[model samples]
Structures are given as structure tokens and as C-alpha cells.
Target: MTAEIGPPKSANPEIVRRYARLLREHGDAFNVTDNQTAIVRMSSFASALICLQEGAEPIMQMTCRDRNRIALQSDLLGASALGVRNVLCLSGDHQTFGNQREAKNVYDIDSTQELQMFKMMRDERRILGDDELEEGPKMFLGAVENPFADPFEFRVARLAKKVSAGADFVQTQAVFDMERFERWMSAARDRGLDRKVHIIAGVVPLKSLGAANYMKKKVPGMIVPDHIIERMRKATDAKSEGIRICVEQIEHLMTIKGVHGVHIMAVNWEEKVPEIVEKANLHPRPPP
Candidate 1:
């Protein structure tokens, strides 16, 4: 799972401890986001290093929103030096969506370029600009895909681009509607993209109906089915109901043709991660 530092992304002592709990108790490794939502906080490299010191593996993120090609390659090498063996490349959310609406969002290289850059650095032993590295970063590279994203029919094709560009694995956005997700997965399988990338399905546990409504309405590239909202509304305990819903999603995800595992996004309800992981039978994670 790609665990958040915070919404804006932080690297405080408390946030580090929370990360430790998630990694040591409930998950295999945690993802360190790169200025999520474009609101500045600690660097993903720093957060990942912190996770490493705490005995947790980190998936370092490098988004095209903040760095140019030079900075991107440099930061990736730095991450490798700090023992971050996994990297997730992404095109960040627009700056207009963040608290700092006026900040310039640099997409000098879109997400696909980010993936290709990481691959070139790792596999070719050279940066995208053709500078050679003595010893390239031997890292497991990843990319993000949101099956719930618009033009859903083209989402699988985009996944194909990621794989062809050298993404070793992929973690999709929070998947609430298994039906739609399966449809996406089917197309991915049909094109053989699933065979090429480790597909980690993302899941978010709905803490309350308010959260559900917010995701349904506010979140872009998200698809939260109305039945889930109705279930949350009728629940005697919304929290417990959320857990059950997450578990249900996990089970359904496991049955899909090419899903390798699940990435549980606990969000604000991070403390409840252990519960969802345990109840969903994801824990006692296999030793690395």
C-alpha cells in the first residue's frame, strides 16, 4: 500500500510513527507521496528514508508536477542511495486543486515520461538525456493508473502504455466499484498488459456517509457506487460497515484475473488499517 504522509504530506515525528505502525503491523511496504495535491510538505525521498530507518520499506514517489527532467533524475538517484528500492512515478494533481492555487504546475514531462525516465535510468544505465551512470539505480519501478478515470474505455490502453514504457508494477487509485474495476481488468487482460505488470488494486474504507458523499461528488477520477452510499446510510455502525465494505472489495479484487494484491488506503482513518488488513486476511504478511 502507498501510505500517505498526510493530506498535504508531512514528515513530523507523529506522522513517521503512524507510518511505522502501518508498515510493521498491517502492510508490506508504504508509499511516500510527492507533494500530494500539490500542497508542499516533506519530500517523498525524506519520508521514504524515514520509513527505512523505522524498518519499513518505502515506495518513493516522483511526480512530474514538481520537478523538471534533471531534478527528477537526480532525485531518483538520491532515493536509490537512501535505500529506497521501489519508486512510483506519477503526474500529480493540478495546482489549482491545492491550497496554493497560484503555484505553477510543471508538467515538463508528463507521467509517462516520468516512467520512461526511471526505466532509462535503471535499465539503460543512463539518464534520459544520455548521461551514463557508473551503476544505475537497481530499483523496482512503478506507475499509477485510475481505472475510474474518465474515458474508462481507454484506461486499459493507458495501462498498456505504462507497461510498454517500462513500469514494473502499478497501483491503481481507490477502487470502490468492483464491477467497473473488473471491467477494466478484463480489458487489461485481453490486451495482455496484466501479464506484464504487477497490478495492485487500491481500496479505500469509507469512514462515514459524509466521506462517501465527498468521494462521490468531490473526488475527480473516482467512481463510488450509490449502493455503497446506501449501505453506509443504513448501517448501525458506520465504521464497522466501512470495514466490512473494504473487506468485501478486497475479496472481490482477489478473484479478479490479474490482480496481484491490494493497496488499502486508510486515509484519515489510518488507525483502522490494521483492522481492515486483519479482517480482510491480508496480514501476517509474507517475510521479504
Candidate 2:
């Protein structure tokens, strides 16, 4: 669920509630944002709690760029107290990339350290400094993996490090280069990571030629192929064609042995997800 507020503040209740309603109606878990792309959006936890009230399961996104270790740990506890179970930990985009470019960056602890802290609280029933908890919070830990990141050879190694640090699952960056993604998946399987973690491939259907171009040229750690861009350029109905491309990608992903699931991130386009899911025949999701 992409709740891009389009420069609006969080006080606009509709921004959160409307997306929450969409998630509930579609029976899809919501992924509320925490200043994604370094833009100041609604607090991820706030959106998550709103979605929870609307009867949708939410995955709160946390980043290390803004909060220190103490704040992170406190927020985790607060999130748990508010009934949040799943979390996606990220190192976060740099502050200079967002509207608040002048704001100081606070990467007091890196993502790996944050992952370890989460693991400590959830698995070992302890937090940083090794204080014991009579009962630990039940959390479904998740992390981000950018297969398109530079030094591609090290991508899998980074993923492995996250898993070792205590990630239960990984939601990768938006994938458009299927060939590259296949190679990455092969590496993941070869390294036996498929057995250790649930890997959810991210898919963001192109809305237009402009969106495709923006992704290819602007987004960091993203890989959009030239052919996809050309196809969008020539297509009369770019939006429909984008959905077709995404469906094809989902179909291909289903055949890959190590792939566990597809995380469709149709930003601010939640309305299109049900169509994509239906076209991909993902209805009546399998039992756990």
C-alpha cells in the first residue's frame, strides 16, 4: 500500500484512512512508509496503527537515518504495544535526497546493528546491553535487499549478513531487470539463502513512460531495462501495458524455485494491485 501524500502533511486523515480502507477491502497487508525516499511523510507507525484500527495487518517500515539506538528500541517496544508484529528495517535513503536536505542525518546505528537489536529483543528475549525480558515481543522480522545495487557480486553477501543479523524475510528493491534478477536469485539459491529466509521480490508496475524513465534514471539501486522503457513509450495504453508487464514478471517469478512471494509495490496505485493479483491468479492465498 503506497500512501504517498504528495507534499501534504499527515494531519490529512484521508491520506492514511483511504489507503487503510483499500488494504482492508483487498485483504492485503499494508506497508506503511517511514520517510521513504527521505521525504517527510506520516510516521510509519502512525499509519500502521491507523491501518490496524481499520482491520488491516500493517508492516511498519523503520529506518536508521533518523533515530538513535535508544529511540529505535523504544519505538519498537511502542510499536509492539500498539499490536504491530511485522517490521521492515532499512538503512534509509540519505537526508540530502529529500525536501529536508538541510536536516542533519542521524545514522547513529547502521542497519545491521539495528537488525541485531531487533533479533535480540524478539529471539533471545533481550535488548542491547543484554537485559533480559520476561517475555519478548513476537515479531516477524524483515529487511530490504537491493539486488540492483552496485558491486553486484556483494549483494548476496550483504543479504546473508542481514539474515545472520536476524532477518526472517527480505523484500527486495523494485525489480524491472528480470535477467539480472534471475541471476541474483540463482546466487541466492546457490548460497542456500532460500532455505534460511523468505524472499519477496518487489514489483512496481509502471504507470506511464515518465514513471519508467524516472525509475531508470533517478531511483538509486534500481534497474529498469531499455526494452521496458521502449515498450512503454510505444504502447497506446501505457498503464495497461505496465500491468501486463508486471503480470508477466509475476508469472515468471512463480516458476523460480527459490521465490517465496511477490511484493507488489504499486506506489499510490493500490487500486491496481487487486487487478494484478487477480490476473496473476493469486486469489485465495495458500495456507501457512
- Model number with the top lDDT: 1
lDDT of 1 by residue, 135-176 (tens): 899899889999998888889989999998989999999998
| Candidate 1 residue pairs that clash | none
Q: What is the lDDT of residue 267 in candidate 1?
A: 75
Give residue 99's lDDT in candidate 1 (0 to 100). 79
Residue-level lDDT for 213 in candidate 2: 97
Tens-place lDDT per residue, model 2, 1-288, is 221212125567676776666555443466777888788877887878877887777888889999999899889988998899988899999998989999988899988888889999988889888888777877788888999998999999999999999999888888889889999999999999999999988889999999999999998888899999999999999999999999898898888888888888878677787788878888755433
What are the TM-scores, per candidate, against the unseen true structure? 0.96, 0.94
Quantify all predictions' global Cα lDDT against the true fold. Answer: 0.84, 0.83
